[model samples]
Target: MTMNERIVQPQALLSLIALRDRALQAESLNALAFSMANDLYPVLHFHQALVFAQRGEALELLCVSGLSKPSEDSPYLVWLRRASRWVASQLPDQQPHWLARDAVEPPAEIAEGWAEWWPAGLWCVPLQRHDGQRLGLLLFLLEQPPAEGLQQALSGLWQTWAYCWAALTRQRRLRRWWPSRRQALLALAVAGALLLIPVRQTALAPAEIVSHQAQIISSPIDGVVERMQVRPNQPVEAGTPLFSLNETTLRSRAEVLSKEVAVADAELMAASQRAFDNPQSKGELTLLNGRALQRRAELAAVEAQLKRTQVLSPRAGVAVFSDPNDWLGKPVVTGERILLVADPAQPVMLIQLPVADAIALEPGAAVTLFLTAYPLQPLKGEILETSYQAKASDDGVVAYRLLASVEGKPEHARLGLHGTAKLYGERVLLGYYLLRRPLAALRAWTGW
Candidate 1:
């Protein structure tokens, strides 16, 4: 009752009363009601108060004040919860009630430091819906003696609290329903307008060419990049020499070893031929000839090292990315990315389009891309790629990435430039685009 003045203010009450309209959200009601209960409770007593919510729940803490959220969930509150459920279940009508008038006393088991606050009288009251359907219960636990007139005041305030709860809860349900109803009517009006107006819109579809995209390319081998020859935006042909590594020592040793290996191989072959003529010498040649094979293998290893000195391009593309800060003249290790060459002849557009809209992009669709850098120019691209792979954003929204290809050489276009595309796709009626996602989510949630 003490907190009732602020809680029952005209504005908040109106918000609550609006709940029954079948057009408001239950959360708004819950929030407003929680706020009122919070403001009202301290006026009554500072110990603590909670305006809990219910579903199948007899009551769940909707909001609380007076006790900082318990460092741990308070056991006393836990006891009240079980007891409330037991009591509500016993009633023929769904509502909260006096689960325990004095059946149990607060025990040390309830919370830490409980010995300081001994046995207290506790009670549970029902929070009923406007139609008198019970939604949850209200619990009151206090020192052994509730002060004079306190019981009366609480009882009087309980009705107001219940009204507030019912109004707010219903309003929540209404907010959602009303929007849906409005949308239905709006859709009808839109359909009517479409029938009356003569207009045609072109359809759009995504393109046929999509490429795998990666940034921050890594090197394939572990070696110091002795040299870096490519510059930013430098276009290189496939297998073009991009850089080289120091192989002076490796090459010279390889040549010397190769000559020795060739000599050994020649000697081994001569010995094998001689052994073939002497039938009993077969075993002798096997043991004496393996050195030639081993030496030849060593020579091949040197030759491979010589080849790795000249780093070659794996693909034909423009080296659009080479961080000067981390590049050439610097000692780089194997697997370090010296450069990134995106497929220049076949550059694809990457767009993170929302699923709601992306679903409309039919395969082989067309789109218009406009770049800010070239405001006067427009490019045609096709949606050749749509990935079903969706990722959840930090805020928990789902989105899919799409790839579209521009038709020709991109003049003044740069990688990662901010550009917008008006993608054309299937010609669905306008309302489907607006309503489908929400309707789908609702159906999934309700299973109806």
Candidate 2:
């Protein structure tokens, strides 16, 4: 062996072992790359070091000596990448070698930037796994060539680094695939348990306050309403006149019948007086008398209809209806609902549950009402009854009507107070409770 090929000093050997230990102890590929580029300055005696790792079909610069992170867009780095690619292509044997500007002919672009960015001598080291797969490249710039013994030492040292690099790279790949497989499994188990939690099924619907035992007032006869005596929600006594219907037709009919009755009576009397002189007159007298009785009955019926034109309240309560103008001049049929005589103190909840939001509801189901007038102070009630058939509500949506009695007589609650009501049903899994509507919508859309 030549004199320059002698083994390194004991101190240098210790330093080499220490560097290998540090590289093996590195937690990540980045830490190892940092150590290879920066920590090797004291042992290798190089002016600058650039570390590159193989990424797919390209070489990616990982780090630079004395820089925590190298800017890939910098002019020097851009040029170095091109130079590294050219060097990587030339190294078919994947071995450590020395490079100089004049020793190897490079492409025109790489040759042009060599003098400005690099020194006279350059050492290229390709880091590879035991199976000969290229892992990374290390380019060390030197003002003077490294001794043959140090070169041999570096070759062995990098082999150890390649092994560590390959190990770290495999660990990094696993980390990218899944951060922690065990923790992910634990989270899935927790989520499954949470899905099984029991929760009560509930639905929201629009509700209103109405009287429990209210009297529905309807038209007694078919006539046009001429006037309304009491206003909406106005308090009144049992004998109070509620409204008056038009009496023009009834009065005219009564007057005509009265005149007809008088004429028939006069005919009957004249016939009776003539009956004494002629037999024909006596036969006409019976017909005249029957005609007079018929006219009188007709007049009595007309008078009775006239008395019915004036409507009166049957009970003492608040008159609940729309505006008085709605009734005035409007013709109504017999038994058509006009207003309601309801007791304000006996208030109950009326819920119009939409068909889409309807759930399994039973009598005496718990109901919580949030009144629009008194939103902060909610009222509690229980379902009394529910309509078996769905019908168009006042808002024009198909809904089922539900009646619920309030727990106590609340002074603040009155007729016509509207709000939202929450109805609770049987308990079910939390997953089912939350996914009920979504599942229903999905089924509707997919027809499944």
Candidate 3:
């Protein structure tokens, strides 16, 4: 039948409408390509269909009839691509037309495979938008030439498919550039929920195990440290000798005073014996007695000071100090700290919280100590005291000194064990906990 006569058929009209609806309803370009290759058989009779989409200046195979997806390396596809490129180059107008092997000669390589892979007739359809942008090309391999009426029908269908392709392509581009409103809202809700999660505000600071009620062992007299009676961390009993000041000077002075007292006593005795015979000697007797008493007082003071040269631990505990060599031959003034006699069982955590990292810490706040020596076994503690003012710590950072009592005195707890302490403050939102430092830095930079 003629093209005009066939276009008037109700059944063909309904089929065209149905096909257009299917193209319009396609969710993606791949789905539309599949329908174009596989679903178009009812509208047009063909041995096979190949779909190609324009990527750049070249047409790439999107799908093929009778296959879920086309393999690019397949011999059939390889030859088809070359043939399609030659055909596409011939059609500058980007129009749809039928092709035959003899009508337009393809390259020898493409022509050589035409008889083996394709049918006698081929139809080329260029899928273009209303704005003249070429979307892709469609090819149909037919055993016999299509009727004039079929060509006219396909032209109308091409227009509908091209329009749908353009719409779907724009939709895809939009989807790529921006998420759908529903998806964006859902993501925002998830992020808000995550930000609202409650977490404990915490900070990490350098810490060490120290004696809670340690005895301060200081030099009792001004002298050079003669010796350390006990080693560092060594256990000592009450009244155990801890250290001693140099007693050589004090001892010599005591000896001199003792001799002076002896001399004064001999002089006084001689004067008392002489006083029995002469009145002048009686007057010297009082001066000799006074001199003897002064010597005795000086001797007693020297003896007392000599006894103080040796220091002893007043309580049973461990001696916490640096190397004995550090103190040996070291001159120390009176009341200078020598070493600590600490109760190892009552170990406390001493934290040096840097001023920059200091948070709102309160008494009884949580503290977790991970000692360098025993990191695997963490000890829990609570803040017992916090320094009212920030001072330069041993490492020279201005920090607030915090003292925390260990919850359970573990076996590894001992004086002078160094570690890192994690101190926790009031709970806050997870967002705040994560952004606290960053926000602080931002505020410092922007002053906002």
Candidate 4:
């Protein structure tokens, strides 16, 4: 009689025939589900409703209108469940449809007067498949009751919805597995790359390697370097003869002086005899005697000069030749230096300190040295002398010179074996380097 009656009246006859056709040749659910949700949105007063092809009871809530979900424990689900149970009982032989309180078959008074007299027109009818799966609910919330044609449409598509839900579940399972697998592979590749790379660093300290000042010796005398008595690096005691000059010229002069001395002795004897003979000749005799005596003294002076030909050592220790010893036959002039000897018992390490450290050091301050040749060994020494003034280096950096002594003949330690000595007068943690020092310097320089 009404539009609702027009939609629902033919459901019993039409649904039975449609079910048989679906059982015989079933299809995927997409078309049938779209028809249902599209038709239902207008009837239900809903803004949006998307049908999902998920198997079993995965969908949590049923909203007949807007986005409102009626909970499972609520009276709406109980009413829907009762209706579904009644429909499932007469399932194969009967068709599913919304029933009033006075249905001829299994009757359902569920959602009675839903839009007839109720304030909000809400009701739900559960749909089921022949295979005993809950296919979801047919939502019906409307301002007006459904047309009789609507029940025939709902009953027509249970089988198609079941097949589509199974497919969706399978796709969901696949999607969940892929992303984690991709991320795991990326992490493993990064770890492998890090392991293959290597790191290296310098083995030597930068500040420790530097050069200092030293001296060279030269020849001082005029005669030929007749012989070199000392070998290179050989130790010598103080006043030892390092080399000797030829004594030929001085020896000849001494022989002449000896003849003069003999003549003077005879002359002096004659003068004394004359004086004894004649008292009047005493003054002349005295003058002759004085001349002979003075001549004798000059002869003694010449003899002494001959003894100085042999060269003598000036100091005690090892000798380093300034030039090749093969040139020993070459002549040298007066005041020329032949060799030098130093104290072998104590050897010193010299370090050039930077301007800041140099200014801090004073004589008698303690220091320590560590040589590369004896890497694990440390030697103790003192600052015996410090340059009171600063000298600028070739790079324009100013520095002061420091000296430290090695304790013993260190194994593998030799003169000119390169090494370093730490001249520590202030205490600072080794970790604090550029930061603490540079900021302090900046502050001082800027007067900030």
Best by lDDT: 2
**Candidate 3 local lDDT, residue 320:** 87
Ranking the candidates on lDDT from highest down gives 2, 3, 1, 4
The TM-score between candidate 2 and the true structure equals 0.60
lDDT digits (tens) for residues 14-128 of candidate 3: 8888888899899998999998998878766689998899999888888899899777788878777788788788775777777877777777887888878888878888988
Q: lDDT of all the models against the reference?
A: 0.59, 0.89, 0.88, 0.53
Summarize candidate 4's per-residue lDDT along 326-432 as a digit string, tens digits: 64677777776665454545567666677664425567666666777776876666667767666776557677656655555655445555566666554433333
RMSD of each: 14.7, 9.2, 10.7, 25.9
TM-score of 3: 0.56
TM-score of each: 0.44, 0.60, 0.56, 0.40
Return the top candidate by TM-score.
2
Backbone clashes per model, in order? 28, 0, 0, 24
How far residue 224's Cα lies from its native spot in candidate 1, in Å, is 2.8
Better of 2 and 4 by TM-score: 2
RMSD in angstroms, candidate 2? 9.2
| Tens-place lDDT digits, model 1, residues 220-282 | 444555666677777777787777766667778898998988888777777778786787677
